[model samples]
Target: MAQKPLVLILGPAGHTGDSIVEGLLESGNYRVAGLVRPSSLTKPSTEKLRQRGVEIRAGDLKDSMADLKKHLEGVDIVVSCILAMVVLDQKDLIRAAKEVGVKRFIPCDWATPGQRGIRPMGDMKGEIRDFIVDIGLPHTFIDVGWWMQLFLPLPARSKREPEVHARVNTEYAGGTTPTALTDLRTIGRWVARIIADPRTLNHPVLICEDERTQKDAFEIGCRLSGEAESLAAKRISISAEEIESRFIKFKAASEASENPMAWEILYPYWTMAYVKSIYVMGENSIASAKKIGYLDAQALYPDMTRTTLESFAEWFYALEEPAYAHF
Candidate 1:
């Protein structure tokens, strides 16, 4: 296609939402639309999408099939970026889109596709994907890693300097499995490219930039900050016991659906391991624009890119604009 597909990104108003909108608009090829409830529309992020010519549709997954059908009209692509904790009842939008004959769909699976069969989120995506196929709808799961946006504001202990940023090392899948993190800029950029290409439809696409551990992060951070590494840093690992404990903690806190500190604390263990569910994508690969070369997108995308964890910290620091305050 000469131009990218027209897309409607549902729940494009949170941290990742703003970046995705910018990526689409900058391409000068894709027509953008954003799906938001009245609340998201009032948020500052909505204005960013609006300025990019994204039509803000005032509706949500809570809407019935008819209401969803009304909003999805003439939509070639429907991306679910909804911030739903559990998607048990959230399959309404997918069903409605299929009924409306939408060409392509991107599920709100910001996690890794390797997680599809293993993690709770993976099961959720699997259920949705299965139903979509049974009903014969074309879809793609834009499975990305833990977003790079989360690592910023860097532990509040650092030296300010122009040459370097604070270093951040993370290991989500215990210390053995690689922790693949994507820059929000890359996710937004990748989403735009996926919409532009039709070949990616009906396939699962995973994008993660680099892998690094806590030890590596500290080493890099010290170099950037112009200081020798702190000898006190300890390595942390995500074990089954840790994951189980976290699940218990979160479940207890979320009894009334009151998500608080416990939920965030426990999620890294259970959520990451479970979501790291392995599915077929040519032997668990990481893909990115920098490695594959953005122009020749037809080939199999690279599993990982050259962007390291330490360097990503620098990029986030540089984009010190108001709209994307800290991610």
Candidate 2:
């Protein structure tokens, strides 16, 4: 029998990474494998993926190229699911893939490109893209829009007054500005199809289940949570200037803190960056590239189901109660 195409998922233990694995498995067209850190061996999700017949390879980002080359031995495609801090580390992995002659490389950039005043995250992704192209590696950048999950309040933080679900907030979330908000399942489905389709190679595929403003999503959430739209909790609207100010403040605090790596400082830094990207800057950010131009790949793949905010709210609340209880 001819061997099936092998896809090695680097950083498969993450929520997005794991979703990619499930999507690929559902398709059953590619031989799936995952590259996990050595420390993640004990994770339940890691073991679950292994039991699902995924080939498991353990290696560190710090591993030498020659040492990491073994993991790419038979990998036909490499999809990286690594996060922010470890993003630049993919350079080493890319070098190893080139050394092993992998066919296609997918970097772990699920979000759209960054814009002016955004953090080094977008800049780093751009550098990665350029490096991949310069090395002559055929690649596909899957630019899925903002995750609907982030818009909803998670279980752990539900105890506090949930702001995202609020109908009125200064975050500039809900307005006429159409932002592509997507659900994880939809992201998984699109990514799997993109990986299998040869045409998607060397191009960026933009995806968004729904293009609506923050207010639209908030209204859907209010209905889902059984909240009174008229009596919805709200905050003073945040502005772009305020967001930029907070970004500088948070970044300065993060650098000045006794433990710069502390979560207290890091959380604010992340939150500020996020608010700046989605709320303050909106389409002015890097993700605006797809928002402004490019033919959405969803048109190319008509069969892929798009999830609306109402549908996402239903699915989201089904998993957990509407977190508006605190309000």
Judge candidate 1 against the unseen true structure and give its global Cα lDDT, from 0 to 1: 0.60
The residue ranges of model 1 lying beyond 4 angstroms of the native Cα positions read: 1-4, 115-117, 151-155, 158-176, 226-231, 234-269, 272-306, 316-327
Model 2 clashing-pair count = 8
lDDT of 1 by residue, 1-327 (tens): 455567888777765666677777776777788888876678877787677688888987889899999999878888777774645555788888888999987777776444333455566767877777778888876766656555433432434331123212333344343445677766777777776566677766666666544445555544553334442242334554555565556545544454433555446534434433321122123433233222222234453244567787666445433124331
Model 2: runs farther than 4 Å from truth? 153-157, 160-170, 229-231, 234-236, 251-262, 284-287, 291-295, 321-327
Evaluated at residue 327, the lDDT of candidate 1 is 17
Tens digits of lDDT, candidate 2, 35-68: 8888888899889989998999998778988878
> How much lDDT does each candidate structure score?
0.60, 0.73
